[model samples]
Target: MQLFGGRKQDEALAKREEQVRKLETECRTLQTSLEDTRELVRHLDQDRELLLGALEHLRPGMDVQPQAQVLLDVCFKPLGLACFYVALADWDQDLLRFVLYHEGGRFRNHPSRRLSDRSGLSERVLAGRRPVYIRTLEEGRAAGSLLTAAEQATGLIPHSWYGVPLGRGSRPSGLVSFQSFQTDAFSEGRRRVMDALTGLLSICMDGPPTPQGR
Candidate 1:
């Protein structure tokens, strides 16, 4: 009888241990879900602020410089972008000229490169007249050559990047790109927001022949 009692107690203890392990697993899953919910809420707030700022600051009649600055301000922190660039297709010279190349809290001078250059992802977007999104630089490199020697030299290479063609012509007139240092930073929702933002940008970018070296 004592042996049987001992066996039953051991069985009960094992069952309790199993229940405790299951509960711990459930708690971890709940914690992760809560964190994801918080992140989504943060992104929604940022999107709201970005759209409000765009409405107030971005106007179709604005010049390239002012509009570009407004765009950078509204987008940089809200979208958590590490770099943003606006490169127009100069088909006449077969070049892609960057009007705005912003990074590290300021703009940088970007040299014009031939449209045929595989390194400039902007050219690929223009050529395809579509969007290109890479979750990592390794993915981009695997798809094709990722960056030019000059761009690589900057030492600010992004972990994730996305770009969309601008304008409705047979070939896009330009491209607007956003870069992030964190993998999977730009979700489908964020990409959709960027698409809307680019529409406003296209309106602002319209009107003038983008002069060389802007």
Candidate 2:
């Protein structure tokens, strides 16, 4: 009877050990999931800040058009660009139409009604819905005639250009462009920042949906 009791005691201890190990594993998994949730919340918060900044143009008595233009212009400063353009995809014309443009700290509304689907840094982005950073105009492939009438009228073409598609999924509805007379003006960091800014811009203007969590 003493020997039977010892065997039963050992079995119970072994079962308790197995249960403890399983609990530890579950705890570790829960800890990882909690960390991931925290990180996602942080990113969403940052994105909200950006969206609010862009929407500040809608305040009462504010000049909405010029403010929108300048907001995009200043955002390009971090990219070290001298000029920026905002274009929307025109389904009727099957092209990207020039809407707002900023240069030399001046905003031009409806600079041109011309559709841009031929070639240039802009068309490439409109076609692919992806950001394209050009180090210099010399290395451009089939983009020699990409300048808009308004841009040409200014008598200055940026030597380098960076353009981002402004919409979600495979096809975007608009384009945001940054350009500079200096060659290789865009860096990897600048491109990444523009990606975030463009997303926020879309959220503000187009009401792009983000993950729900305040």
Candidate 3:
């Protein structure tokens, strides 16, 4: 009888040891998962801070447009943007028209051609009030039917493009566009960053700039 009791006790101890091992394995897995989640959160937080900081440097003021252009040059030029344009809303045409254009490295100019009331690219963007990032000119050709006639007329071929609408509420007031000579230059992350930059631009355009002559 004593031998039988001892055997039962040994069996129970073995079962408890196995259970403890299983629980420990599960605990380790849970810990690893928790650590991974924390790391992801940290990375996301860092990215958010970086974006906010960049936006802060471009915020609206008397000097906003020039500062914004500088910010855009620093941020987008390295990413392959050859030209950048900002179009203000034209109520008569119900479209955005280029108000400021930055060409070369530091020259601020205006667009020679009008983009308002166009059908394909600018029209689609103004209608949707969303950002359009094209990796290839072929994609733009397919997506921007409004620009076909103009492109053909001017003998211009856009190889790559990115555009973001600027506005408040449902009525978009303007657009910011980036053009590249290379295909597939803009990525989803770049689009998001451009969206953030445009948001700051909208705020800058809300009030007229103070005059210099006083």
Candidate 4:
């Protein structure tokens, strides 16, 4: 009986130890899950702050040009790309006349130049009623004779490019184009930024034009 009692006590102790180990594992798993939840909350808070800032910038009565400049400056400067706002006169004309160009660094502004009337890409984009992404300058040059001439005249060598059409319904008002000297510089992230900027520009375009005197 004494031997049996000792054996029973040892068994109880072993079972107690097994229970403690299982409890410890469960506690560690809970701790890890809590940490993951905290990290997710922190990321959500950062995203909320970012979205709020963008909303504030998009408030009504803002100057369109300055707004566009701010968008390009903040969005593309880090990526090292040039941004341009082209205001078109007529959708049927198949032209994108330059309204403004925001250089990445200290580069001087190249004066506004007329688009080549024969540019099919420009016309197709305007008439197609959708945003057009020109991935390469070579594609543009090959599609239209005028593109090559324009490149030579301005010395604007674009290895990669993306453009968005700006207009409501049938009246295509303009286009916004981003360019980079490096090939395939516009990644998926950069493309999303451009989309947001273009959305803001589209809203601004619908409003009344600012007075020349102002």
* Candidate that scores best on TM-score: 1
Estimated TM-score for each candidate: 0.76, 0.59, 0.58, 0.56
Give the residue spans of candidate 2 off by over 4 A. Answer: 1-67, 76-78, 109-117, 141-145, 149-155, 208-214
lDDT of 2 by residue, 33-57 (tens): 9999997677556546545565564
Query: How many clashes (backbone N, Cα, C below 3 Å) per candidate?
Result: 0, 0, 1, 0
What residue pairs clash in candidate 1, if any at all? Answer: none
Candidate 4 Cα RMSD after full superposition onto the native fold (Å)? 8.3
> Stretches of candidate 1 above 4 Å error?
90-95, 113-119, 138-154, 182-185, 206-214
lDDT of 3 by residue, 1-214 (tens): 9999999999999999999999999999999999999976775675576466666665555454675565565566445676677766675655455566655544454443344546556656776778777778778778853343444666665577877888855667768887776788766766776777677677766755667995
Better of 1 and 3 by lDDT: 1
Q: Candidate 4 lDDT, tens digit per residue, 85-149?
A: 44454435534555556543433344433344534555555556676666666775665523334
Q: Which is the better candidate, 3 or 4, if ranked by lDDT?
A: 3
Candidate 2 weakest ten by summed lDDT: 58-67
Model 1 / residue 151 / CA error / Å:
3.7
Ten contiguous residues minimizing lDDT sum, candidate 1:
143-152
How does each model score on lDDT? 0.82, 0.67, 0.67, 0.62
**Which portions of model 3 show Cα errors greater than 4 Å?**
1-53, 93-95, 103-116, 145-157, 207-214
User: Candidate 3: minimum summed lDDT over ten consecutive residues — where?
Assistant: 106-115
